[model samples]
Target: MNTFHPQYLNDSQGNTISVVIPLAEYEQIVKQLDELEGIRLHVNTHTGKRPSIPLDEFVRQRMAFSKPIPPAHNGEPIGSPLL
Candidate 1:
């Protein structure tokens, strides 16, 4: 077994768990990891953070806060000479 050679292993959930290989495998593993990173970077570059509030949801929230309630009547307008 090459001291630096390696082999990939997976867990029960199909996730990469460990790598066991000689030094020769280092380059390949590094390349794969780099490719994965590149893909991630590319995706992030293309797609930025998604808007948390959609247009309709934003309008609804704005309206809820901006609506005015009718003034309470005290039986008559103040200073109108009538109660």
Candidate 2:
């Protein structure tokens, strides 16, 4: 049970236009939204009648079919080989 203290911003006519919350609260909200999105995706995928493969087999199949990424240059970070 999380509680937030939000401040309202108004326009020239004093009509509320937006709400502001603390930075930490904003970050928490974003994190919760990301988690909720992951949950929603998982639920949607599982609700289908399609057959599923073991995680290892799925990873293997994906890796076998995926094209290799070109190497990063000029000190750039390298992409994951498994991606």
Candidate 3:
């Protein structure tokens, strides 16, 4: 449970119309809400147990997809192999 010193605005009929909270409290609430949303997204996106990848296959796929490039600090051209 949480407690706060809430301030309220009333309409002409003395009905509660709006409420105000401290800026720090408001920021804390926003941060909590963002965290809750992230948790909900994670729950919704995962359907089953994660698939496992073998180390040998992972290394082979990685090597096939990647290429070695010259370092940028040497002012070498990109994509083309250095002589």
Candidate 4:
């Protein structure tokens, strides 16, 4: 296992304010988080319907669902309110 010591920065009041970790460790953590996110998304997609179907049925159903849908509201531009 790779272990590292983190350095701390203190404020004028002599209290620890922040910590600094190695860049390699930070990159590794980020990579792990990304992998976890991918796994979570995959699981969520598969579990969208319970009692997951067999490989063949799943492929067929996925193909059916992958079909293109009609454009929205006569192709009018839609604005994102949250943006």
Q: TM per model?
A: 0.34, 0.58, 0.53, 0.51
lDDT value for model 2: 0.86
lDDT for model 1, please.
0.66
**Ten-residue stretch with the least lDDT total in model 3:** 74-83
The residue pairs that clash in candidate 4, if any, are: none
lDDT of 2 by residue, 1-83 (tens): 99999999999999999999999999999999999988887887798744567989888988998887766787564777566
Which candidate model has the greater TM-score, 3 or 4? 3
By TM-score, the best candidate is: 2
Off by over 4 Å in 4: 49-83
Clashes of each: 9, 0, 0, 0
- Put down candidate 1 lDDT per residue, 17-77, tens digits, no spaces: 9977765577767887899988887787689834366877777777766645445496543
Highest-scoring model, lDDT: 2
Tens-digit lDDT string for candidate 3 (1-83): 55677899999999999999998888888988999988776766696544457978777777777778757877875764321
**How does each model score on lDDT?**
0.66, 0.86, 0.76, 0.75
Give candidate 3 regions above 4 Å deviation.
48-83
Model 3 clash pairs are: none
Model 1 residue runs over 4 Å out of place are 1-20, 49-83
* Sequence-dependent TM-score of model 1: 0.34
**How do these models rank on TM-score, best leading?**
2, 3, 4, 1
TM-score of 2: 0.58
